[model samples]
Target: MTAALFGHDGPWTEEEYLALGETRQRVELFDGSLHVTPAPTPRHQRIARRLGNVLEPAAEAAGLELLEAVNVRLRPDRIPIPDVVITGPIDLDQVNIDAADVRLICEIVSPGNAATDRVLKMHYYAEARIPWYLLVEQETGSLHLYREKNGHHVEESTAAPGGLLELTEPVHVAIRPERLLD
Candidate 1:
């Protein structure tokens, strides 16, 4: 069998996981298991980019940086790649951001990622104590925003279609669900 096909099988240590480096697919390690997903589709990528653009200025103004393609380490064996993350300053060579440094995490829900993004990731981020969470359901044109309170995530705001979702905590920024993919 080709190494690429079965190389990542079985349990993975942090070093081996990180050594996979930059692959076309998204690879994550959690609970000593490796989870791999195909690259984001064009539509998915567009939504991520547009959303990143919307949050860039606000993040910078808040003394944070909006980033993607960076791993957020929640535990020694728990690491996942968020679609978007607003974090404190980072060294350019760093491959991971400590959960404590992450201010906000955004995940865009697509047909393939709905369950993971909405349920698993939500639970994990809250467990990591990430202060804010934004869930964008693309097909429905809706946005679900949450904030961490008492170490748990609480729904803070939501919007549908052209509706406006305004957030003031962690940073001040307003987002319209429809504009995220435009």
Candidate 2:
């Protein structure tokens, strides 16, 4: 695996970093290191869109906000672009306006990213103390909903075509398993 690169430490501000322009691939900064991710595949986009379709209506009804493929600052100089992110309704300034303020994060695993999402990203999200993390695996048509329990991650529920997923408390966003594959 190629090592991620961190920008040289200096007086560079967040606005300066965010304003930097690039016309190539998507890049992320984790601990001041640059991590370049491969372009998402068509199947990846399909799964992400399907998830949004189900959640958007429910979120709207609950007065929540839906952000898609947006860079969420998880820590200072560290940002990870979740496939689907949901937070409480708020003005732009009150939301994830910088490198923090993300409540729930989701990632749709593509071919090469399956292992990394399962291991690296999984641990990253857990360590970040995100209340809820959702993982959708296209190959198995599986949806794994993880809730933070006892300061660790517990697979609260798994749903496939025949199963029904319950969001439980808090966000209370639920959708049928098959809808995720649509």
Candidate 3:
């Protein structure tokens, strides 16, 4: 991920990060350091919105909630804001959702932050034992679904634009990659 490190000499604690409060930019805490990113581009936001819309109905039917850009506290030292998340019902006043409540986490690949999404974040989700991880490669219009198996994530399926992405766990649903881009 292309992150602009803060001028601080050392990593910030979780309490310190929370004290910063909400800001215009998106900030994630990883490895005790803060990884800050600018607001998403219009295209990125559009894709995220569309994907959320496509998933909401199915999620609701399965008693899951679809939320966007919410902080997920994976560990005491790690809090990553996924682009889209499917989880059990969360209270409106909740500051951050615990990893245990998360059913699925999705990251829409940003050109500059591809590695963070595909590598670092993927590992973090696996380590947290999150059930499902979805990776949407924006440029390629592809979707990848990873399932947690034996404490690690393994690719269970992949679909290209106009292809169907089917999921059986965390709620059964089918999505088309093109719908997310459109």
Candidate 4:
């Protein structure tokens, strides 16, 4: 009955993917496949929270909002719940938002899925033409900022340990990477 409803013979459509309701893990729809990722660790939550705190003021000043773990539909067939995102005012009742509304998307690297964040998602976000992508590596307590140019992402800045992550685009904010962890 379930398979019949979703049509297993063809690629999952946007309607079918959105109808997934809720699941145990983070699920993203890309092309004809579903990308499932395990739940984040408590530490991952902490970093996102800390980043939001520091970024909120600047984001608000620029008339953008900092949101965590919200679904962003990059296209009719691509939607991924980015860990953190900065966007213009949104309808609170919306289930998800268009990627065009997103000013910056952040992904915290899961310990075992570093490549997914560093390589795979980077490609997706870049391909989606998102202006900025921020990656936080928990193991090294480092932050890497990439700016999309042409059709790919280029490293714009990096902050690690005693260094500071500073940026003027998307929003103007600066903070030490160590503060994000502790």
TM values, all candidates: 0.94, 0.80, 0.94, 0.92
Tens-digit per-residue lDDT, 1-182, candidate 1: 12754865667888888877788888888888877898998999899999999899998898988998679998898999999999888775788889999999999887977899888888889999999999989889899999988767899889998789987867788988888865
Ranking of all candidate structures by their TM-score, best first: 3, 1, 4, 2
Q: Which digits, one per residue and each the tens of the lDDT, describe model 2 over residues 1-182?
A: 22212444554344544655442455665665566777788778887888888887777777777778776766676666788988765566532434234567789888776876787677777777778888888888888899876656789889887887788544666767677675
Candidate 3 RMSD computed on C-alpha atoms after optimal superposition onto the true structure = 2.8
**Model 1 error, position 48 (Å):** 0.6
Per-prediction RMSD in angstroms? 1.8, 4.1, 2.8, 2.3
Local distance difference test, each candidate:
0.87, 0.71, 0.91, 0.87
* lDDT of candidate 3 over 132-163, digit per residue (tens): 99999998999999999988899999999979
Q: Which parts of model 2 have CA positions greater than 4 angstroms off?
A: 1-17, 22-24, 93-100
What C-alpha lDDT, on a 0 to 100 scale, does residue 157 get in candidate 4? 93
Model 1, CA-based lDDT: 0.87
Q: Candidate 2 at residue 23, lDDT? A: 25
Q: For model 3, what is the alpha-carbon lDDT of residue 46?
A: 94
